[model samples]
Target: MFRMIPPGLAEAARLTRQGRLKEATALLQGSLAGTRPKPTPARPATRGRIFEVDPATGDATPPGRAGFFSRAQGRPRPAPPLAMPEGARFLRGGFGAAQGERAWRLYIPASLPAGPVPLLVMLHGCTQTPEDFAAGTRMNALAEAEPRLVLYPEQSGTANAQRCWNWFQPGDQRRDQGEPALIAGMVRQVMRDHAVDPRRVHVAGLSAGGAAAAIMGESYPELFAAVGVHSGLACGAAQNLPSALAAMRQGGGTSTVLATARPTIVFHADQDRTVHPVNGDQVMARAGAAGLRAEVERGQVPGGHAFTRTRHSDTAGRVMLEQWLVHGGGHAWSGGDAAGSYTDPLGPDASRAMLDFFRRHG
Candidate 1:
């Protein structure tokens, strides 16, 4: 069969011609077919000291208790990556709002450029701490390279037994109320402390955190330029426990439609059993109902997972929403590190792709 030169090799060849052989060689190694990237050696569970946080009381907790885990019959908990990137300052703090105070962790890259920088507020899934989530997603490493700021807001176990953001709760779903207000307060604190470009602020999360991010985008669109939700539901998809469960299983639980839905990028696994894949469709449905035109693309990454991506645009072809359905995958962050919980390393990298998408809107 005739084949086209892969984009990676094409770029590598260009770099080689430009005398950037080292960069070109690195790209070629990553692009090599049939070879999986070597998994980062698993670090000891005790190494996650930075994430062992009690959101409600702002105290230290055990790392293993950070999230939901389903071992393969007798499999052990996944190991975490090495520590936060060198020179990246990880600070634990609290954000006080009218509703209440929330615990948070901020990742300040050592190489932050002068002037205002982009901020990505990351929400953690049920039973997850900011450290654990960041470890699994390996987003902090990406931030080190981009030299961007990253904020992680912890969901209190006092609020939910699972430590999940209350995305289904009406109080948390609206602006200036419950968790939304508290998270927005955290964002404001970071912005005030550092030179954060308000126009470039973005939010993203996994599962419960992902759903909560969708709610945040809906509740405070002005604060976030874009939103990325991985294995999550759209905002207004549920009201209470029963509805939330139903929506998780059966999907289709849109409660409201905003005049203008914020720019969104959603990633879901077709084989996900924790959250139905149809929820991804509902996210697109809600965005489409809000007047964005939908364009779909289906392809597979060589020697990796296949995906169906749909980009929703406006009349002028401005993208408003991008939905990714990872085929043969489970409920996890696409292209995430093995050290963190609920991550699939074989899929497309959600962290890198989300950052790229956020750049276009702001």
Candidate 2:
């Protein structure tokens, strides 16, 4: 059967041919992940440094009292990749608003050109840190070559048991309250600190993060020019814990596809057992495809899974939405680095694709 090249990968190959090969490869790391250092063995528990953090309470468990946790949880995996890219800076900061305060990590590129730059807000999945998400998605590495500023708003363990963005909660779904307001305030804070193109502001996430990104777009359409959702549900997919579980198993009943919905790009695997693939359809529905031209393309990453991408464009031939369904893939970030959690290195490069799509709208 004939196949098409995933657009972002194709563009990367083209840019590589035009002398961007080294930079793109360094950033995209389609293969750098293969050379990632082997997982190190866990260290012996020492008296002073051996504290177990309670995932539920974010409190330190006395060293001797870690027996239950040691039995319950497996050996801790190594830390996520948190090294700053050469010449780039990864700084820590915090933002507070009406709802609450959240600590965030900001990634600023090196040798940035004069004037305003694009700002991307990234949300991490449950049990993921900003550093883990960046390493998983390879967005920070990509920003090293692309010059966009990336912000990762971290979810506090105290906010939810799993450090999730509470996207399924009714309070968090609206603009002026809850997580949405806090996150939007962070965007404005970044804009004030650095020159940012208002039209170029965008947000994207994985799983819970992806769901939160949809909520951000829905709540603050005027702030985000576009949104990217991967392995996530549509905004308002759930309003409570029970409904959230059901929505994760199957699509939900909430439906809102306003014409003003921000431009959206989505990725979901047909084999994802966590968030149902039908939720990807729900997210696209929220993008409002009415009156747009539709085109579908099939592609496969070399030595990776096959994918079907549908592009929706306007009368002017500008793409407004893209949805990719990866066959045989799970609920991980697509085409991600092995150094981070919940990443499938064999899938398509979702980071590059989402950024490419975001750049088009802004």
TM-score of each: 0.78, 0.79
C-alpha RMSD in Å of predicted model 2 compared with the true structure: 15.0
Q: Residue by residue across 18-49, what tens digits does model 1's lDDT show?
A: 33434444554566552324323333322211
Off by over 4 Å in 2: 1-75
Task: Quantify how close model 1 is to the true structure by its C-alpha RMSD in Å.
Answer: 16.7
Model 1 regions lying over 4 Å from their true place:
1-82, 289-291
The window of 10 residues in a row where model 1 has the poorest summed lDDT is: 47-56
- Candidate 2 backbone collisions, by pair: none
Whole-structure CA lDDT of model 2: 0.76
Which 10 residues in a row give candidate 2 its minimum summed lDDT? 63-72
